[model samples]
Target chain A: MAPSTTTTYTTKQWILASKPTGAPVLSGPDATFKLQTVTLPPLKDGQLLCKVRHFSNDTGLRNFIQSTVAPERFYVPTVPVGSPMRSGIIAEVLESASPSYKAGDLVMDFHLGTWSELVVLEAATSQKLAPLPKNLSLTHYLGAFGASGLAAYTGLKFAGGAKPGDTVVISAAAGATGSMAIQIAIHLLGAKRVVGIAGSDEKCAWVQDQLGAHACVNYKSPTFVEDLKAATPEEVDVYFDNVGGHVLDAMLTRVKKHGTIAVCGAVSGYNSDEPMALRNWFELISMRINIKGFIMLDYMDKAPGILQELIGAVADGRIKLQDAETMVEARIEEQPEVWMRLFSGKNQGKLITNLIV
Target chain B: MAPSTTTTYTTKQWILASKPTGAPVLSGPDATFKLQTVTLPPLKDGQLLCKVRHFSNDTGLRNFIQSTVAPERFYVPTVPVGSPMRSGIIAEVLESASPSYKAGDLVMDFHLGTWSELVVLEAATSQKLAPLPKNLSLTHYLGAFGASGLAAYTGLKFAGGAKPGDTVVISAAAGATGSMAIQIAIHLLGAKRVVGIAGSDEKCAWVQDQLGAHACVNYKSPTFVEDLKAATPEEVDVYFDNVGGHVLDAMLTRVKKHGTIAVCGAVSGYNSDEPMALRNWFELISMRINIKGFIMLDYMDKAPGILQELIGAVADGRIKLQDAETMVEARIEEQPEVWMRLFSGKNQGKLITNLIV
Candidate 1:
């Protein structure tokens, strides 16, 4: 293939249409899918035009969209409508106007916009992509070894405060962040007992079998509360809250005195029109519990070190990666269906979109 | 004094007939004042016979009563019917079988059955009461310089992590614990802005003028939320929460990031037949706030030192004490009405029932 010319090229793209009232819908009045034919604007002095290789889809993207539409609710305004959807993408530079980057260099760019086929991004925002380590897939960069990886690592390291012989309970234990947190707590932190709360029995089994979790309780089970209490006879020391709502309430009741809760996400209530009510907050005062909420953006400086350590663990076979394939290779319409699969509890492990074959 | 006899003596005492369902009725079937004529049991080898002088009336007493009637909710077995009411009291030793104490020595005792004429207590549990400094009233031992004083100092110092120039918002600002917490935060801790929340405007005014709070907000006012927000524009850094119903919910919405809330008591919902529901708990996760519940018993070791410091502060005029005197002399019948006065907002400053005229 002769070198792709930046002078004339068309790329498929997706853009936001209107503000979503509740759960986002695909190809609806609220969300317009535009297959736009656009020319690449001339690169500035410190910019590069790149061919998109792979991109990430994250749960936080919805919050980001809402934040953009409603600025008053957040400390900062969210992404504006008609602007390129914020994403992290692996790409190959086809043309460069900066001394720091050259044509043909592979890199990761945070400003990769619009789920597009081709794009131009600022040179300062791109970091040269290192080759994927042996046994570690390129997709790991989008999941465990990327922002998600640092999020789990730092959250557990700082907030969990997990000491040896401590009991750790994690909700949403099969998802990207939850899976990593469980493993770190058990194998790395030397936690005595590791209990996981997942959406389904299969996810629970996966966490137990693949993550070395001492016990797994399916939140959907009728005996979830009993099972949780039985699993942690001495009360949970660290609660990694990934799925809030009823699961959070259950954890709050069972947490020990002086326990720490890392509030990473609330996937369980994200799609609900009315959030669940918390009736047992008085327990918080009686138990002297500590709850801390944070996003990965606050700890960006630790990304490189966390990624290196994660890569080593994967290479040594000490940490196992559970890859959940939800992507449909046949058509683009399947993208919306793949995203919906997460809500139905059909998807396992880290779900990603495979754009190229 | 006839050299207070070590010989057993018979005296009349009140016992718990039944647990109160809601607001404790002074003369009712649930809590009958039984004048049991019984001989004072001989003290054990390391015990002392404490002539109960002043019994403390605390919010915890309500929980103790409820727990006594309903053992299932309590951590331990309930206090049996006809047993003396459990309480903390300042007493004088009439007779001692232990070498640690002698007759006439004043002490603070935690052995229950304080709604009586006498008590048999462990010598180790009895802390020798320090001599009252000049200008410090003996009744302060049952209120300001007693459990309430230590609770406020410890909660603000450790749980609240209060720093100078920080804004501290205290609930139940005119009651025993609330008043002590305000004085500690303002005088002892050197906080810049102190905001007090009370049930009525008169109590709020008293808190500002008598207790030295920078601003006071009446929770009963229609403009309560607005006034609180305006008074604490910098946002509350340390919240000493005593009233935990709607007042806590409102305070939760205004806490700054990384703020600490010391959940000392929930007086607002203490007497309710049903516990109140908190609406704004989600703010805890987003704000990364830390809320801790504590009992004075947990920090009992620090009591003597804390009491000495408080007494010194009062003596040196570093902190001014507000005397909310309900009676010049304490009597058995006055106990119920004295406590009821607190709920009705009838007393100003620190409410105390003087046992000695």
Candidate 2:
């Protein structure tokens, strides 16, 4: 009954070696990440070993790295210097000592320190993903059908109050959450108009063409203000902000009376020490705008229901699975370079790293 | 029956000859106000002539004067160069040409250009007060039983959502609206702790001692920040902000999660061309505070019911009418100086002008 002794397994992980003062340069000697290889331990009772098939690169990692500084700490704690950098992961159970998981069973883990070829976790840690139905990839669980999708659903439903015929403006529209938000607003919420703000022309094009957003404004354009104005002819009814700072200020002037703004992320200021000054904040009084800060961790209870709805939508073709136009693939060893794409806006859709390479 | 001839009535008015570049100086040759004498016009059908008794000096008049600047205009129109300055007035009917009114009827007239001694109005233009009930003075209609009282009632009930055990902070807490707000928060809403922010120690003392607020912080003191911090040991629940700017910034940092800020006015910026920057606006996101701008004009429909409750509270011993410790008195001729006292924070309690002098 002993397992085959011929093959041995080793795990490779990217550990946080130092705290970053600014944006982390992944390839330098002073890089924040350090790669390490180690032998796998025998599975303990109530534990399972998973081969992390895909790593979900996220902009929130910027906040994670800064958590070492208490005053500047964000909503959550950072990955320790000697531990694996944390992220959402799509994995398959390779070995199991728990009754809940068996070999070859797939799962989705959220913030379980996932930047590794193989990770051992307590059986209670991750949700067991059902078999990947037709037209859905294993990577979809880390994106369109996962936490980001649930956030888009909850934020738009409760915070944005997105309704039929509403004009919704979403920042970071080509990123993971934004892509899902745009599709949900258009296909599910029946939004009359959806305008997106993205950094590059290609990303903007993908956001408009693939995600079915009505318009996409390149935030890097020289005529960004004018483009934004043209994109939103009428006052905006709901604003889903991801990249805050000047974009938020510009939208403050554009939100209609009694409009709502869902503050999802502020990636623009994550790298800077100084918080940007919002000059037109008085408009919050004049226009009666309601701005609410949102975090997905607070709404975990709604995830099961939201994920169910998303899975059905994806399967029935109501939500186009191809909406994610680009899935940039990289080897597990290339995670440092791949993650930089998230902050640099180089990834078109979701960025997934393959563990097999 | 022919009425015996009596003393002729002459109307005194203050007209705005030019727009102010900054705060209007009343005594200078380039004064914003110009006093004029005019003969009383004959009352037309459905018209009544009233002698104005008391003029209500409100900071909102600052916005009224600003109406000439098209885009920045307040809820109503401006007092044109040839017209008398506008204000809420208490008046007695001297002559009636309509069945609805008769001689000696007391009434409250809103925006009736009270900077004059005698005025003619259509019978339908004013709310005729019931016969002078005991424990009520003519001045009460312009103060505790007037617009400010109604504002405090509705603002606390809805905008601020003040309730029992709620710790409330009222900025400009010794002024007309603020004084009423303090009493309403303490007596009506049963707020556990009420803090007042006033300009001087005398005003602060009166606000605390007479208005029944738990604590008062003089914003003019050298240790204002420490004083405010000591006054509010816990995160504030409801902040009734009347003076917005630095005070608003300070409160933004101290507000608890889901706190509500009723932004009734921004007195600090009324005289300045530049709007002050809210540096801690990000707190709106982190704390999830809701800041609502309230204009009483929008809530006119709620006035009748609210005024009835306020009048009853004043008639009973529940609300002390003598709570206004400093009712700064001024002669009708010193209207310009009295109005200037409002902007300079020289007046305590409500600023009332006696028309007979």
- Candidate 1: where are CA atoms >4 Å away? A1-42, A50-55, A66-77, A80-95, A102-120, A272-276, A324-346, A355-357, B1-40, B65-83, B98-105, B272-285, B296-298, B324-357
The per-model DockQ list reads 0.27, 0.22
TM-score of chain B of each: 0.89, 0.91
Per residue, candidate 2 scores C-alpha lDDT tens digits across A235-286 of: 6999999877888877877787778888887777776665555555556656
> Which stretch of 10 consecutive residues in model 2 chain B shows the poorest summed lDDT?
B66-75
lDDT of 1 by residue, A223-322 (tens): 9989888988888888988877778877878888778888887776555555455545556656677777666666778777778888888778777885
Give interface RMSD for all predictions. 4.8, 4.5
lDDT of each: 0.72, 0.77
| Chain B TM-score for candidate 1 | 0.89
Point to the candidate with the largest DockQ. 1
